[model samples]
Target: MLALDFINIGNGDCILIREMEGTRQKFALMVDFGHDCLVRDDHPGELDPRSQRIYAGDFLRELGVTHLDVALATHFHRDHIGGLGRVLDAVTIDRFYTTYLPPENAPELDPFHPDNNLPKAARSALLCLQIFTEALQSHPGRIKQFELVPGTETISLQLTPDLKMDILCGEPALYRRQKEIYDAAFNGERNGYELVRWAKSMNVCSLRQRLYYHGKEIVLGGDAYAHVWETVNLTPCDILKVPHHASFDSTS
Candidate 1:
């Protein structure tokens, strides 16, 4: 049996995909553990009292999950990856996947750097990246592999004998264009504001994954926008995780 749990992490995404044999789980994959505010007590204002929020790590522990076959962060947004640190703290991961990798030498990647002047959203994304990188480094032996999902082409993986996954991303040219802007800002050739503005509007680089199991297709659209879907060969799906939180700009 294939089980997919969309954990409630208010305003964010935390999905657990499991392949089970009877009562035992045979394989497990997680996608985008939500923001830190959901688990931390210090950020009470960030949590909505009306929404029941639970930490992905704690939830996994309760389910007797000790290891994860894979953990994927679809993008750099805080809502997508902020709680990754806590998840690492609770369970060991085999492979970690992400869309973009921050350059180690980029000064602005450090949120507290004196020269860093990125706007809040961009800064928050950078901080989440920093935290995740540090967490991986701190547990070098636990996380067996870390890699960036290539945006240049569509890649397919067989997660299990019956489960297959296909990853589709926006055109590589779009990602490269954004990278050029980021590189300029990092090297001090362009102002941080330019990078900030670009970050606000660009979700084209986010990953869109299709899961095939038991003759059913499930599409998990990260923060990908309408323009990104234009480049994809979309098909009928049994379930679709709406992009950009189903915002007006998500669909054409």
Candidate 2:
């Protein structure tokens, strides 16, 4: 079996590909689908994150990607999940991974709105949110919505040999109720312009591995703080799927 190809999906994103071993060949695996809004991708403006799905779909149809083995969502943010709906719409999902921050039901929260940050406008946002909500609500007895709890787990595949992976950090939730508590020391204070940076900081770090292959040993460090990286025991790797999209600035 040839090693999977990490297709440069652009803007610090990629799609891991393998020959379709559906039954006679192989299986195809993919990571986060990158962005939603049509921006100028590395290849061309015509190729947005949607292209990732198209690429995957076309590969599957020709290569036989009838079912997806794994789909890991780094966080709840848009860039990571925006292009996921199309892929799901096309193929069957076997295992889904995500950092589950339980839905905070605020009367102000328009659950109909997919994105908690941006103003409601995009159809993909709404549709994706619907898909997630339905999945969480109508889960089978054994299905689980994985959350990033405090610990390290080796994400080993059945077909791999000598690849090791683990969950590194945690993304805690915030509460806004009768009493408004602002813990600037822990969560960090935002000076107005730093809101995006601040939001980017609260994501958990995840690891990835290729296993005895060329780009075999890799680490996908998600939006983890410096302390998180410093305190943890990381061995290092050939490549790393950065946390929070490579805006690598932490107050050390």
Question: What lDDT tens digits, residue by residue, belong to model 1 across residues 1-252?
Answer: 999999887668889999999989999999898876675533455555676778888888888898999888887666777777778878888887776555665453466565665567656545655665665556557777777776788878898999999888786876676667656545555355765666675577778889999999999999888877876567899999999889888888
Per-model TM-score versus the true fold: 0.85, 0.55
Clash pairs, model 2 backbone: 20-26, 21-25, 21-26, 21-27, 205-222, 221-243, 222-243, 223-243
Model 1 is weakest, by summed lDDT over 10 consecutive residues, at 39-48
> Which candidate leads in lDDT?
1
For residues 1-252, could you state the per-residue lDDT of candidate 2 as single tens digits? 434554433443435544433345354456655544435333464543345433333444554456665656654445555555545545665666654433433112232443334433322233344444444444332222343332234445553342333433342332121012112211322223333333433343433333334455656554455555666566656665555455655324
Give candidate 1's TM-score: 0.85
* Native-to-model Cα distance after best TM-score fit, residue 106 in candidate 1, in Å: 8.1
True-vs-predicted CA distance for residue 186, candidate 2, Å: 25
